[model samples]
Target: MHIHPLITDSESLKSLCDRLAQSDFVAVDTEFMRENSYWPELCLIQIGNREEAAAVDPKADGIDLTPLLDLMVDNEDVLKVFHAGGQDIEIVYNLTGKTPHPLFDTQIAAMALGLGEQVGYSNLVESLVGKTLDKGARFTDWARRPLDKRQIDYAIGDVTHLATLFPKMLERLRRTGRGDWLDEEMERLADPSNYENEADLAWKRVRISSRKADVLGRLKALAAWRENEAKAKNLPRGRIMKDETLADVASHPPAGQEGLARVRGLSPAWGGNDIGGRLMAALAAAKPLPADEMPGREERGPGLGKEGALVADLLKLLLKIRAREGNVAARLIAKSEELEMLAAGRREGLSILTGWRFDEFGRDALDLVEGRLAFAVKGGKLMMTRTEHSQ
Candidate 1:
């Protein structure tokens, strides 16, 4: 495959994208820095097809990325391929307010193919294509300007390996008849809601130590306040306030803005700061969280009794056995929480009992939990067998 020189001009990038538009799929990768900011700083983007590849400089002066961006989000004929590309898609969404359509994530597909859960790019490449990648430039500061040949080579290497492996992987999926299994997952990766940062709902992401109505209300207000502040300042949410500190503040009310200095995570300067006053206002306005909206209720599952707990454990064992027998990732079949729900006799809304999941492992899970399936030994290996009670 021919690697084009670093793309820094619109015409060159446009031409590259136009040629790639005719291809069946495009393998893409991005290099960005997100350590100090809420938004990732996109520095380099490597895009490729089987015949060619190029590294586009996203930070190049006076260069517009609309052409490349259009290909990712607008073009429907070509599939956008990536390995563990959740962050990559997030970067694109940050820039364009849309994720790439007709998407495919090799890492997610690997789960169905039995490669493993959350498979890293290096491992996937090595496993599928048998090519070992150089790890030297893995930590390079992509934000640095005038990238060297070594850096460019390492960056471009990512898409090149992906471009090579996709066809072979697709073929294997076809042969095994598991290609359709990835359809729902791919659609999920393309959903725009996954990339949105709705501030009102941000508190859910923070770990909580209290379930009290007032505490939850304050936490909800504080988390929304922090999200707005982080977005305005272009800083990380943790830089504004850490999760533990947020939870602590919600649990313990200060007398006023002057009391902010006594807060463990806040600096003494906060005692008299405007932001400290903002926190006080948020706390003052907080109301008890409505019972209807409260989280951690028993109805959300996870309330298995001792006997139900034993059945959940047996269901997990059956999951392992089925995943091994089918050569698929256990998580792709059912989650631990879902098993507990099944064991607890709450089957109406469970995802494990629906669609492909039900066909894959949920059927046997239902049988096992309902006492129609049992574990047995055959030739010194643990295996699943139906009890006489099963039809």
Candidate 2:
């Protein structure tokens, strides 16, 4: 529990980064606030190796992050480890315009090691390192100055526990001969394109109830507009317009300001303001989407009627059995929609059909669907059995 001094100045940060550069790998974590902002406000960055840990105050005035960023990018040999690193990587990518290379995400690694899908850092530490972390400062205002010692210790504890967790997770991965699986996962995490916030793709995040092409077109336009405006004004997307309001507007698009004002869940002031005008303009500019270009709905299974439903149910059982036997997360190998698609006999481009997933569960899933495999109970345990015809 030896907490190092908070690195507030460029000199200290540079010195710390230089010292960390000698390590083979470093565990990293960040504490940030993003509730009211378009981008996450990186308030504190915690970095540690096997021996010691330090917290960097990114909010400190005139504290240049170039040296830290340099250490992240130039030190290719040293692996940068994180747990559930999407947001952390997004922050670094937003600041430095590049994702840290040689990345290792413990959460992703945990899934490969059968811990669970998106395992929490605290859970990982408790399970592996036999320690529970203090989460009192989990929701504290990180942007505020003069952070208390407790808050600083909690922040540093994030990376310190990670320093212990990484080795054990890595050992499990190697013992299971699933290092390649983790490599595949890390490759996706390290891709900068995955972190880039493109405004045009913003519609994917909105949950629109209607499946109409025209409705989808308007929703896409409005969402894209909201994204660009939020980024330019440094406001959250919800602050611009709530997702429900977006859905409502898409369902029955407004022709003008008056119509916009009448929409449900929208305030009179919001609908009468400049934002309302932009929303009207977006809807007006939206072209009628063709049927082929309409947003695709999630597949529940083929139109095989009751039989399709039965197959989906069987697939669910098979997935649970396969996941348990392989000691891996079921959701990681194949999601519900993927299972539906498999039951419907549309297997192209499915994640389950390729890589380690294919070897683990995909083949069995396919065989079950094709009547080449059957489930049987033996010794009070359910197991897959080969059909005589298949044999």
Q: Report the number of the highest-TM-score candidate.
A: 1
Q: Write model 1 residue lDDT over 1-391, tens digit each, in one string.
A: 9999999998999999999999999999999999999999999999999999999998888898998999999999999999889999999999999999999989888899998977888998998899999989999998988899999999999999999988988998999999988898899888999999999889889888688999999999999999999999999999999999999999998988888898999998889988888888988998888897789655356778899899998999889888999999998888888888788787787777888888988888888877788999999988788998997
Q: Estimate each model's TM-score.
A: 0.97, 0.93
Cα-lDDT of candidate 2: 0.86
Model 2 worst lDDT window (10 residues):
295-304
Report the poorest 10 consecutive residues by lDDT, candidate 1. 296-305
Candidate 1 residue 107 Cα shift, in angstroms, is: 0.6
Model 2 ranges off by over 4 Å: 1-3, 290-293, 297-304
Q: Compose the digit string of candidate 2's lDDT tens values, residues 139-220.
A: 8889998999989989999999999999998898889998888787798899999988887778878886677778888888
